[model samples]
Target: MDKKKRVIFLVDMESFYASVEIASNPELVGKPVVVCGDPEKRHGITLAANPLAKKAGVKTAMPLWEVKSVCPQAQFVRPHMGKYIEASLQITEILYEFTDQVEPFSIDEQFMDVTASQSLFGSPQHMAKMIQKRIWDEVGVRARVGIGENKIQAKMACDRFAKKNLEGIFELNSTNYMKKTASLAVDELFGVGSRMKRNLYKIGIYTIGDLAKRPLEEMKKRWGVNGHILWLSAHGIDYSPVKNDSTELQKGVGNSITLPRDYIYKEDIQVVLLELADEVCRRVRALHKRGRTISLSFRGADFNHPTGFHRQTTIPFATSDTIEVYQASLQLLEHFWDRQPVRSIGLSLDQLEDDREIQLDLFSHPIKKLQLGKTMDEIRERYGKTAIFRASSLLSSGLLFDRATKIGGHEA
Candidate 1:
C-alpha cells in the first residue's frame, strides 16, 4: 500500500496589526489603515497595512513619511504588541481544536499538520475554510490558508497564491508546484533573497526551473550545506517537522535598543550599556540560566555607510549577574569602540548553562548577588517590573523606564 500524503496548512493572518486595530475599533473599518511604530522614538516604519492601504501603495517596513506621501488619507495606528500577542495566543488555542501539530512561524503565521485530522474535519479544503471562519468569527481577524503535501509547499502556496486568491485558499502539491512555479524567477522561491538570487544568476540559474534542473552536487559544491538546502527547496522538498515545544530551551538571552538619538559621549554610551546589561541579565536569570560569554555590538549613526563592531568575551565562570556582564561589555566598548556616534547598541549572554550550581568566589560574593537578583525578580513579578529598578535607570541617559512600558521595542 502506498503511504498517505501529508496534509499541511499554512495559516497567515492578513495585515495582522492593522486588522487587530480595525477589529477593535469599528470606525476604522472602511479606511485605509496602517499600523506603525512611534515616529517620535525614531521607529516609524509601517508594521502592517490593510488591503485598502496596500491598494494606496503602502507597504510593510516603508518609512512613515513615505507612506504619508503615497497615501495621505491613510489612518495610522500605533502598534499594541500586547494585544497582538493575546490574539496570537487565542488563535493558537483555536488551532489546537483541530490538531496538536501546530507550529508558530511568526506573530501572524502558523503551520499545522492535519493529516490525521481529515477523518474528523473533512477534506483539506473544507478544513482550511473551517479554520479560516473560526479565526474570523472568534478573533475578528481574517486568515488565508495554503494547503500542501509539506510545510514548504504550504508556505509558498500561501505567500504566492492564497494571499491573492479571492477565496483566500490555495493548494500547491508535489504534482503541480513545479508546473505552477518553475518558470518564475529564482528569487520567488521560499528562501532566495536578493544576494542568493544574484549568486544563482552568476551560475546561469535565473528561474526556479533552471535551479531545479541543476545537479545537486553542483549546488553543494558552490554553497556547501546551504546550497544543498536551496536545491531541495527548488524541488519543493523539506523534511523539517512541525514542532510545538512550549518549554524549548533558549540558547541565549539578549536585548538591543535603537537609541532615540545618536550618543557620541562615552558616559552616555556607558549608561545605555548598563541598562542593556541589566535587562539581559534579568532575562537570563528568569530563564534560570547562567552564561559565560558576553557579546557587545553597536552601530554607528551613519546610515549610508554603516560602521560598527561586535565582540565577545568569555569569563572564567558562568554568571547571571548584571554588574559582571555590564563590566565585561564596558571593557569591549572601551577597547573596540572608535568613539563614533552610536545609533543602536546590543548585548547578549551566551554559552549558557542551567543556573542550579554556583561557583563560590571569596571576593565577588556570587551567592549573595544571585540571591539579590532572585529577590528583585520576585518583586518585579509580583508588583510590576517598574516596582524595583536600579538608580541608574533614573539617570538622564537611561531608557529603562521607557523600555519597561514597551514590548519588542514597541508600545505594549
Candidate 2:
C-alpha cells in the first residue's frame, strides 16, 4: 500500500473581536464600532470593532477618546469575554463535527488533523468548503481555513488567503500555492516579531527566499534556535504534529506586554509590574491553581534580550492574594528595576500545587485572609478587573505594582 501523507488544517475566525460585538447588538451591524478598554474612565482603549470602525480611522489598542475625536460617529463597546467564550465553544463544537483531532490555538485559531478523514471527505478543498459553510450557516460568523501538509504551512495558508467569509481557506492541492503564500511580508510569518525583523533587516534579508537560501550553520550561529526555526519556515519545512488535550497541572502562570514606547521612570515600571501581577493572579485563580515561585523579566529598549529573576517561597497554597505574590516578585525585581529604560515586562509564578496543599497563614487573621481574597475576586470578576485596587496604582501607571512585603531585608 502507498504511504499516506500527513495533513493539517488551520481555522481562524474573521475579525472575531468585532464579530462578537456585532452579535451582541444587531443595530451595530454594518456600522462603525470598536471594543476595548473603558473610555469613560480616562483609560478607554479600543480593543475590537467592525470593519466600518477600521475605515473610520479607529484601531485596536488606540485610545477611544482619540478615536472619537477623529470619528465621532464610531460606536464603542466593552468586550464581553463570556460571549466570546460562548462563540468560541460553538465554533469548536462545529469543528468537532468535522473531525475529532482538533487543537485550539487561541480564541479564534485552531489546527485540525485531517489525515484520517481525507478519504471520507473526498478532497481537502471539499472538506474546507463544508467546514466554512457550516460555520457561517450556524454562527453567522465567517472564518478562513488553510490546508497543508504541516501545521506551519496550514497556518500560513490561513493568514495569506483568509477573506471575510470562507474566502481564506486554501488547500495546497486545490489552490496555487504562490497565489496565496506570496506577497506575504517575511515579518508576517509566524514566530517572527518586530525584534526579529530588525536583525533580518540588518543582514539585508527581506524575504522568505532570502532566509531560506542561507547556510543552515551560519544562520544557527547568528540567530540560535530562533534563527534555525525561521530558516525552516522560509523553506516551507515544518514537522510539528497535532497535540491532544492534556490536563497536566500547571506549575505557573504569567502575563507580559510590550509598551509602544520604552519607559524610563522607576515608578512607572513598578506600576506596570503591579498591573501584570493583577492580571497574572486573575488567570491563576481562574484555573484554580497555585504557584510558589515568582519571577520577573524585563526587555531592554534595544530588544537585544530579556533579563529576569526568580524566587520560590513555600506558600502552602495557591491563593489569588496579590499581596503574597507581589511581595515575592518585587523582591526579585529590585535586582533589575534600575534606571535603565525598559520596553517590556513579564511575570510568572511556578511550582504549582492543587487545593489539597492549601493552608491559611498562622500569624495573620487566617479566616479574614481567606474571606478577603474570596470577596475581592468576586468583586473584580463581576464589577471588572480594576473595580478595586490600590489607589496608589492609579496615581502611578497600569503597568506595574509593588508589595510592602519585605523578606530578609529585601523588597517584595
Candidate 3:
C-alpha cells in the first residue's frame, strides 16, 4: 500500500502579548493597545501590538515614541512575560487533547502533527477550527492555523496566508502550494531572508518559481548545504518531524543587557561584562555543561549607524568557571573595543560538552573551582538569585540586581 500523506498544523497566536493584556484588563477591549518594554529604562521597543494598533501603522520592535506618533490614542502596556507563558502552557495543554505530536515552535506558535488523529478529529480544516475555538474559549486569545503536508508548508501557509485571511485558516499542500506561491517574490518562501533574496536575485532568481526551476546541483554548488535546504523549502519539501520531547542539545548559553545609558569607561564596561559572564557561566553549570569558546559582543551607542564588534576565542580546556570566562571576555573587550561608547554588551559560551569528566591541569585548580560554583548555585537556588552575588555587582555600573528582577530582559 502507498504511504499516507502527513497532516501538519501550525497554530500562531495573534499579537500575543498585547492580546493577553487586553484579555486580562477588559477595559482596553476596543482600544489600540501596544505592549512594550519600559520606556524609562530605554527598553521602549514594541513587543506586540493589537489589530487596532497595527491598523494605525504600529509594528513590533517599533520605538514607543514612534508608536505614539503613529497612533496617538493608543494605550500602552508593559509586557507580562509570566502571563504570556501561562497562556502558552494552557494552549499547549489544549492541543494535547487533539494530538500527542504537538511541538511548540515558540511561545506564540505551535506545530501539531495530526496524520493519525485526522480519523478521530475529521478533516484537517475541521480540526484547525476546533483548536482555534478551544483556544479562544479557554484562553481568550485569538489564533490562526496553517495546514500542510509538512512543517515548512504549514509555517509558510500560516505566516503568508492564514494570518491575512478573514477565516484565520489556510492549507497548502504539494499540489496547490506552488500554484499559489510560485509567482510570489523569492523572499516570500519560508526561511528566505533579505540577504538570501539578494543573492538569488544576483543569479537571476526573483520568484519562488525561479528558485524551484533551478537545478538543485547548481544551488548546492553556489551555497552548499544551505542552498539545498533553500531549494527543498522552495519546493515545500521538509522531512523534519514534530517531536514533543525536548531531547535536543542546546547550541549555546548567553546573556546580554542594554545599558540604561551609554557606558564609555573601560571600568564600567568590565563591570557589565563580569555580570554577564557570571550569569552565562552559572547557566552552563546548571546544565552540567562546559564550553571551550567564549564570545564577546557589543553595540555602539549610535543608533543610526549601530556599529560594534563580536569576537570569540577558543581555549584548550572546557570549563564553566565564571572568573575564567570573565578573564577571556575582558581580553576580547580590551583588544577589540574602539573606545566607543557602548549601548549594549553580550557574552556567550558555546562548543559545549557534558561535564561528566573534569580535565586536570597542574597550574589551575579545576576541581576546587567546580565545587565552589556548585555551592554558590545551591545557595542561590535555596535563598534566591540576589541572596549572594559578586562584590563587583554592588558597583554603580553593575546590573545584576536589576537583571535578577527581569525575565528575558523585561519586568517579570
On residues 1-412, what C-alpha lDDT tens digit does candidate 1 reach at each position?
A: 1257888899999989999999999999899999998888877889899999999999888989999999999998998999999999999999999999988888899899998998899999999999999999989999999998888899989999999989999999999999988998999999899999999999899999999999999999999999999899899999877778532436788888889998998888889998888888888898888999999999988867889999999999999999999999989997999988998898999988888888878999988998899899899879887898878778888998888888767789
Candidate 2 off by > 4 Å:
1-3, 164-166, 173-184, 246-252, 256-325, 336-346, 349-412
Worst 10 residues of 3 by lDDT: 243-252
Tens-place lDDT per residue, model 2, 327-357, is 7767766765655677667777776655345
Residue 9 displacement (Å), model 2:
1.3
lDDT of each: 0.90, 0.69, 0.91
TM-score of 3: 0.91
Task: Please give, for residues 147-257, the per-residue lDDT of candidate 3 as tens digits.
Answer: 999999999899999999998999999999889889989999988889999999999999999999999999999999999999999899999999885324466788887
* Rank order (by lDDT, best first): 3, 1, 2
Stretches of model 3 off by over 4 angstroms after superposition: 247-250, 285-293, 313-319, 351-374
Residue 324 CA error for candidate 3 (Å)?
Answer: 4.0
| Ten contiguous residues with the weakest lDDT in model 1 | 242-251
Deviation (Å) of 20 in candidate 3:
1.2
TM-scores, all candidates, are 0.86, 0.70, 0.91
What's model 2's TM-score?
0.70
